[model samples]
Target: MKKLLILVLMLAAAFLIYRFAFKKKRAPREKPVPVAVSEQSAGFNQSMNSILSSYYRMTEGFVNWDTAAVGSAATGLETALKQLNVEELKKDTTIYQTALYPLELAKTNTATIAAGRDWTERRHALNDLSDNIRTLLLTIKYDQAPVYWQECPMAFGEGESGDWLSSKAEIINPYLGNKDPKYGKSMLNCGENKMTIDFTKRDSARLK
Candidate 1:
């Protein structure tokens, strides 16, 4: 009888241990959530490319000396912005607002020249705005930022007069006649002057 009792108790304990210990462990798993790209990041690239391409086309028109075409392109760009609206392009749309000032300055300069007025003042103004925009674009991580006058050969020298080019003969080849017209009939009319900005160097280290 005692043997029978002992056997039953041992069986009960074994059954309990097996029930608890032999249960299968759940497999380790990662959360089943979908990874998605932010709309702002994706759309920013698209909008930036579109706007820049349009700006380049307008610049080409200006370089070719087509004032009417430049104005039309600028107008079309502004229209595109209005139609798309900033919210659709980026979460913080104010960055785009910053670009408008220079774009407007460019348009204004082109318009002044087209109106037969002395565009030197407008050009100077546009230059300032362009520089500012370059800085801003760099800050915002825009792909093509303006190259400083130090980097560009024509900005500081090579005006309508040959004095600067003559003086800086050692640094630059004077024999390479000024391909750019300083006192042009109208760069806008011919669409020949396209502004250039440097995109190769970005100082992301300073951004933090």
Candidate 2:
């Protein structure tokens, strides 16, 4: 009876050890929650749209070689850019930091363009401004409208290149501008469409 009792005690200890130590433990499964678009995001989108509108006008001014129009459009673009909520963006640290550089660059260049400088200087500034805006748009994935990235190969000279954004696929070369004093067409159809930003598709994927 004593031996049988000892055997039963050992078996119980082994079972307990197996159950506690050698058992396959289950990990807690994580469920993905959908991110609902907030009012703040919508507001941000509206602000970006306003900026884009001004930018489009500026680009058109350049295409027409209207210095007064370009300067006015640049001022408007600068104002719209200033109205953007940097604090709101800072809530997402990574994105905020990533976007800061381009935002600043665009703002600065817009101001420079608005200063009523010579065409060469303004064109250079516009080039930088366009590039920075492109970077910002791609990084933030602004959902207002589809932006077409267009590049002009002979923008600055024969070999140099520049890029600009447009709401439509059609290319109106802001770099070439008017050929003659009468605002005649120059290299108006100069560039090609490189990319298009459509955030709706990305948002749809996230919904799934």
Candidate 3:
């Protein structure tokens, strides 16, 4: 009976030692944290959206060949551009440097469009403005809303072309610009959609 008791005690002690000494340690779990938007980035987005909104309105005016409306919209775009935080935008050094040229050109062309006497001249300026704005937007990824890049194959003349950004996927030719008053529907859909900028994915990448 004494020897049996000694063996039982030895077995129990061995089991406890193995359980404590040979057990594998568990890895600590990582908890996910919520993403927070910074004030500067939020302001930057607001400014960019405002610029895009004004540009869209200006494009609409061009489509209707309403010079007064176009001028007004251009003025609004100028204001929006002026309000943008350049220092904030400079956070992305690469984007800031690349965007500067286009941004300045957009400003100059918008001013010209606002003051131009001839409709054709204004349209020409508008084309340049559109290109510059498109480049700037693509570089910075201002908003999370999709903008369509549309191209008119016959904008300047046959075989000549121009492109503009639109809020919708549908093509509305600002280059044609209500040129045919007699045929109200003529040249309204003269362009093809070149690309759709889906900003949701793009803006996320920019944030990262």
Candidate 3's C-alpha lDDT? 0.82
TM-score of 2: 0.75
lDDT of 1 at 31: 48
Tell me which of candidates 2 and 3 scores higher on lDDT: 2
Kindly report which residue stretches of model 3 are placed more than 4 angstroms away from their true locations once superposed.
Answer: 1-40, 179-184, 202-208
lDDT of 3 by residue, 1-208 (tens): 9999999999999999988999777888764444433324777888888999999998888888888889999999999988887766677788779888898899999899999998779888988998898898788764557789999998887899988998888888887866645446588898899887765532233342
Q: Sorted by TM-score, highest first, which candidate order results?
A: 2, 3, 1
Candidate 2 global lDDT: 0.85
Which candidate ranks first by TM-score, i.e. highest?
Answer: 2
What's model 1's TM-score?
A: 0.39
Scanning candidate 3 in windows of ten residues, the lowest lDDT window is 199-208
In angstroms, the error of model 3 at 82 is: 1.2
Model 3 earns a TM-score of 0.74
Per-candidate clash tally: 15, 0, 0
Quantify all predictions' global Cα lDDT against the true fold: 0.43, 0.85, 0.82
Best by lDDT: 2
TM-score of every model versus the real structure: 0.39, 0.75, 0.74
The residue-by-residue lDDT of candidate 1 on 39-139, one tens digit each, is 23555545645555554455444345555765566565454434333444244567666655554554453344334333344234334434543443453
